[model samples]
Structure formats: C-alpha cells, structure tokens
Target: MTTALHLAKSDDLPKLSALVAAFHAESGIEISDEARTNGLAPLLNGIPHGAAYLLGPARAPVGYVIVSFGWSVEFGGMDGFVDELYLRPAVRGRGIATEVLLALPKALAEAGMKAIHLEVAADNATAQSLYERTGFRTRDGYRLMTRVL
Candidate 1:
C-alpha cells in the first residue's frame, strides 16, 4: 500500500505525540510525556533544527518520522539525521518506511540538504537491509557516538 507524508504542524502535537509514545514504548526508549512533548513541539512549530512528518492520513496517522539538521563539513552543507521512524505494528512489512525514506531525502535535498543519515542497531539486520536498499551506507570505520547534554 502507498503512503503519504504530511509535514507536521503545531496542531498535530496530540496525534504525533501518540505515535511517538508508541514508537518509544515499542523500541524500549524510556521517556516522559513532558520530555517528548518538549522535544516535538519545537520541530512541529517550524524550527530550522529539524522537522517531523505524519505518515498516512493526517487525522489518523499510522506512523511518523523525524529528521534533525546540522552542518557537516564532510558533507559540505546541511545534513540530516533520522532521529526516529516508526510505523504501527499492523503496518509492518508493507514497504511504507522504504517509501518514506526514499521520498524524504529527495525533498530535503531540494531544500539544500547535502546528506541524510540514520542509525540502525548493530543486531537489526532487517532494518539494516531496509536502509541499504534505500541508499544508506555505513561510513566505513566511522561510528556514531553520542553524549547526553
């Protein structure tokens, strides 16, 4: 089945929050509602730092994706990292995520994004394969390291 991505707006917080909570729970990411809302609100409000999209029907979205932006000297311009991507359990294996990944970068590139990045668990071969098919490759010896601010 085909899917559509609606650029999320401030009014979309409630629905987007629900989807985000579901994704965090399913993925074992522990976070409070306030934190989630705090993180999501700015993006939905049009912060240049990132953007969010609702997948499927806007009023009753089945999933969501968020991409955060930053300058990358190696990439030579603005680059984006896929902060989160999730679809409801019922919609798994339908190529919906693949379609979103493919289409999202095209739009971002048009908006001057030089590269897009996402992290898949080392053991998640399924997601790795999906990412590979959609044109994401490992950075040879480079690994993503993070520190909580």
Candidate 2:
C-alpha cells in the first residue's frame, strides 16, 4: 500500500466522513454522524488549527489521518498532535502507516511545525511498537489528560 498523503479538500467530505465513521465505529467511539461532520468540515475547508489527509487514492482512500496544530511552549513554537489515523483492516500489517508516520512529519517540519505527538491506548501493544519504531516515545511520566467542553 502506498503511503502518499493527499491533503483532503472540501469536496472530499462525503468519503472522508464515511471513513471516519467506520473508523470510529471500529474503535468503539460513539460520536454522532452530525457531530463528526461538523467537526471535520472546517478542517477540510483549510482551517489553520488542523488538517486532514487521505492516504493513497483520493477518490477511494485506503486510509486517513487527521492532525491538529497547537502552540506547545515546551516543544517550542508550533506543534501538532495526530488526532486520528485509520487504515482499512485489509490494508493493515503492511508498512503503510509507518510510511505516513515517517514521511508526513518531514513535510510538516518544513512548514514550521516544531513537534508531533500522538496518543495510543495503554493495552494496544502493536500500535505502541509501531509508534516507538517511528520515534514516538512515551514522555516518561506524562499522561494525556483532557476535558470535554
């Protein structure tokens, strides 16, 4: 599977949304379709805080990745978080996701992003290994805490 990242556009909403819904369902996230669409639209519209990418063919993407930018004083100026990443089950076990993880950050770095981060569930050893191989290390003692507003 190719790991080329195609920046998603406004017109790609329908397909992207469906993939997101499927991914969320598979991951057991219970967000409503309306909520997901509402959240994704602005990013597709080129919002500065975040961006979405369609992996492989744009028309029938094999996977998707969404990144949200922020200012992290600790990491320096601009930083980004891998808000989501999803590849079709049939396409897993390949190095496609690794390719994206390795390649995308260089592009982002050139664009002035200082750091990149992601969150993986504690029990998901496969994902943890993959992330570790790609240079994402657990920050010693830090944990990701969040508040839904």
Q: What shift in Å separates residue 65 of candidate 1 from its native position after superposition?
A: 0.4
Quote model 1's TM-score: 0.97
Error of model 1, residue 53, in angstroms = 0.2
Off by over 4 Å in 2: none
lDDT per residue for candidate 2 within 1-149, as digits (tens), equals 25678999999999899999989999999999899999999999988999999998867898899999999898789999999999999999889999999998889999999999999999999999999998889988899999988
RMSD of each: 1.1, 1.2
Scored by lDDT, model 2 comes in at 0.92
Candidate 2: RMSD to truth: 1.2
Model 2 clash pairs are none
